[model samples]
Target: MNIDIVCVGRIKERYLTDAIAEYSKRLSRYCKLDIIEVADEKTPEHASAGVDRQIKAKEGERIAKHLKDGAFVIALAINGKQLSSEELAAKINDLGLRGTSHIQLVIGGSIGLDEAVLKRADYKLSFSKMTFPHQLMRVILLEQIYRAYKINAHEPYHK
Candidate 1:
């Protein structure tokens, strides 16, 4: 199975990028892992809540375009399901057995994901109730994915 992480903003921090890349490399042994960065919307001063939602909605559309047809989409949200590493591995294995060719994991920007994107996702996952920056979330997601693969393969890296 192939996994793709689609995030709204670029990772500017070198350390964060390096960390994500390292996990990506480790996950490649199990499945193809790719990170896709989308342009973030610029919010002007005194922007209304409605305006902000519109901008986030547009960004969500751009993310939707990158998704492959028939791929299972998973959106990272604060209110989503929180799964353990072992559970995540089982979910991945279940998807694989179900013949899911691609899995798209989406990370929204500062304001969070649009309602449309969340509605479209096959699964909504939450790492924690406390909010995280989008850049850091990418790295965390990558690490979790790597750990999941390790668990699935009975490897020692997950410990």
Candidate 2:
């Protein structure tokens, strides 16, 4: 499967980048993983909440454009379903069986994702109820994906 992580904002921290890259390399043994970073929308000091939401929506649109046609879209949201590593692997395998060749994972900015993007997602996933920084979330998501692959293969990493 070809999995793409579409996230907002560039990872500025070298450590975070290195960690994400390491997991990406590890994931290559299972499937193709691509991480795409979209520019975060800037909100002015006097911007209203509605304006801020619109900015986020525009950013979401940019991310959505990269999604392949018929790709399974999964959005990361606070109110989404939480799955264990084993369950995630099962889900991935199920998708593969369903003939889904591409999986797009969307990660929003601090303000969260636009409603349109959420509505477009085939699945909505939440890592935790407590919010995390976008950069940290990227690392966590990648690690989980790698763990899921390990669990699917009955590898020792999941133990």
Candidate 3:
């Protein structure tokens, strides 16, 4: 299986980048892992709803460019379904069994994902209802994916 994390903006923080690098190395044993960063749109401090929508749309366009038609897409959203680590492992396993070779997990910019990008997703996943910084989300997502692989292999992992 090939796993791709397609997210908006770059990780400028050293600690977050270190965490991401650590998980990426661990994931290398299970599958080929790729982290693709798209340019994020700058949002005004006091933007209206329409302005926010436009920002998301601009970021979505950049994200959409990286999404391959053959790849299974799972976009992260606040209202998305929340699943356990085991369930996520099962989902990945099942997708591979069904011949899905590529999986793209999307993390949106500061605002969120656009309607068009959400519509294109095969699945929408949520880590929590509370909003998280998109930069930190990259690390969290990588760790969960690595845990999923460990679970699928029936290997012991920290609960």
Candidate 4:
């Protein structure tokens, strides 16, 4: 299976960059994992709701650029479906056997995803209802993906 994580903003912190690299390496044994970091939109302090929507739209456009044809799109959102590690592993396994050749997971910018982008998703996943920094979320996402693979393989690492 081929997986792509498309998100806004680069990982500026050394620790986060290192952690992401580690997960990426681990995931490589299971499938092709691609990380695409788009430049974050600038949000001025005290910005209006309209301005915020525009910012998200711009970021959405950039995220859309990395999407592959006929790929299954999964968006990470606060209100999305929350699944356990086992369930996520099952989902990944089922998807892998399905017709799709690629699975694209989207992590939106700080303000969240544009409705237009969310509408394109085949599945919306949420690890938690609580908020998290975009930078840290990337690391958490990668870890979960790696864990899911282990679970699917019935490897000792999952337990």
Candidate 5:
């Protein structure tokens, strides 16, 4: 499987970066994982709805550009469906069985994803209803993907 993570903004913290790298290395046994970081637009000092929309639009364009052709796109959003680890493993295996080998997981910036990106998604997934820092979400996502792989293989990690 080929997994691509298109995320807005870079991971500035060393600890987070290290953790992500660890997960990425661990994931190599299961699939090819690539993480693409896009530039995040600066929020205006006094922003309005229009400004926020414009920012999301710019970020969305950048995010969409990195999407792989024929890949199943999964956008992370607050209102997305919540699934258990076992369910996620099942979904991943099912996608592969159905011949959708490439999977693109998108993580938006602080303000969230635009409507266009959401519309293009094959599925919307939510880790939690509570808010998390975008940078931290990257690591969390990688860990989950790794966990899914373990579960699919009937490894002990899922327990």
Candidate 6:
């Protein structure tokens, strides 16, 4: 299986970059992994709702470019369904069993994803009701995916 994490903006912190690298290495045995970064727009202080929408839309456009045809998309959203690690593992296994060759998981910018991107998603996943920094979320998402793979393979890493 091929897994792609399409996100907004570059990761500047060294520790987070290192964590991503570690998870990517662990995931190499499970599937091909790609982390794609898109440009993020600067939000003005006290911006209006319309301005926020515009920023998300611009970021959404960049995200849409990397989405592959026939790839199942799972967008991260606060309002999305919450699943346990085992459930996520089952979901991944089922997708693979059903012949899904590629999966794209999207993490939005600080302002969040646009309606269009959410609508295009085959699934929406939520880690928690609380918000997280987009950069940190990337690392967390990678770890969860690695756990899912380990669980699916009956590996000892997922304890």
Selected candidate, larger TM-score, 1 vs 2: 1
27-117: candidate 2 lDDT, tens digit per residue: 9999998899899987688888899889988998988788777899999999999998888989998999999989999999878898889
| lDDT against true structure, model 1 | 0.90
In angstroms, what RMSD does candidate 1 have relative to the true structure?
1.2
Q: Per-residue lDDT of 55-86 in model 1, one digit per residue for the tens?
A: 89989998989987799999999999999989
By TM-score rank, best first, the candidates go 6, 3, 5, 4, 1, 2
lDDT of 4 by residue, 61-156 (tens): 998888776899999999999999999998999998886679999999989998988998999999899999999999999999999999998898
- Candidate 1's C-alpha runs over 4 A off are none
The better-scoring model by lDDT among 2 and 6 is: 6
Worst 10 residues of 5 by lDDT: 150-159
Leading candidate by lDDT: 6
TM-score for each of the candidates: 0.95, 0.95, 0.98, 0.97, 0.98, 0.99
RMSD of 5: 0.8
TM value for model 1: 0.95
Cα lDDT of all candidates, in order?
0.90, 0.91, 0.95, 0.92, 0.95, 0.97
Per-residue lDDT of candidate 3, residues 11-130 (tens digit): 999999999999999999999999999999989999999999999999999999999999999999999999998889999999999999999999999999999999999999999999
Name the weakest run of 10 consecutive residues (lDDT summed) in model 3: 150-159
Candidate 4 Cα errors over 4 Å, as ranges = none
Q: What are the runs in model 2 whose C-alpha is more than 4 Å off?
A: 44-47
N/CA/C clash count, model 1: 0
Candidate 6, lDDT over the whole model: 0.97
